[model samples]
Target: MKSIVAVQFIAAVFFATAAHAEDLEFVLVNDSSSDLVEFNVSPASSGNWEGDLLDSGYLAPNYEVGVLIADGLQTCVYDIRGVFDDGSSVEDYSLDLCDLGEYTFLD
Candidate 1:
């Protein structure tokens, strides 16, 4: 009986940790008139922008891709930036990615 209780406690702890470490995922869409050459995201509290998530790939106009934020940060607010092939860039501040299931960048 003691061994069974210990196993159950371990399982409960494992499940709780798994649930808390889940990754935040969302779809990124390009609705602009140009191709997106760069896509970057960073926590709202951090002033620095991380590397591009595209990894040498480009999102053409009217296209979309799935994005996963696995940084394990606690905050849901983030800053998103996209650079277009037309030499122009756009940015969004304080976006709640948890509630934003999908994001579309418009021209």
Candidate 2:
């Protein structure tokens, strides 16, 4: 009976910790040239969860490409690489993100 009670208490604490986590969304764009391009965005380090936001062969024109990331209380560095469909490529760029809200790019 004592073992059963201790197990339940541990399980409750584990679930409670997992529930109060922060979720972040990462938004990337290719505001460089006027051509259709593909890119891959991933976390800089290992054991970091990069949530689902975009897919392969995704065309991110001179606009904003949004991606959603899992909830966590850690600084996440994203790697953005421009992958061209044809035999061409573009320069790599960096994005500054925060937990405020979405970013809007104006002309």
Candidate 3:
């Protein structure tokens, strides 16, 4: 009976830890002009960014692209575009996640 109780307690702890992970996504766009441009998306907390090329042949005016944020950190998105490109744009949308408080186990 004691062994069964110990196994149940371990399973409960594992499940609780798995519930706190978060995932997020955002979109980027170009609003004006018909020129080829390149842009990058980055996580504000980690300072890690990825670059994508958006040229006249690949991207259209006012086009949107989606990006994914990794787990275990609070993230904010940013838009990095070339200056030669003409357009007004916005970035930095965040995902929603649960807040974990102190936990207690009882008999």
Which one wins by TM-score: 1 or 3? 1
Clashing pairs in 2: 22-71, 23-71
- State the local distance difference test value for candidate 3: 0.33
In candidate 1, list every pair of residues with a backbone clash.
none
Query: Which model, 1 or 3, shows the larger lDDT?
Result: 1
Pairs of residues clashing in candidate 3? none
- TM-score of the candidate numbered 3? 0.37
How close is each model in CA RMSD to the real structure?
13.8, 15.3, 18.7
TM-score for each of the candidates:
0.79, 0.42, 0.37
Top model number, TM-score = 1
lDDT of 1 by residue, 1-107 (tens): 01111110000111123336556677777788999998888878888877877766688887777787777666689899999999999999999988999888997
Candidate 1 C-alpha error for residue 16, in Å: 19
- What overall lDDT, based on C-alpha atoms, would model 2 receive against the true structure? 0.38
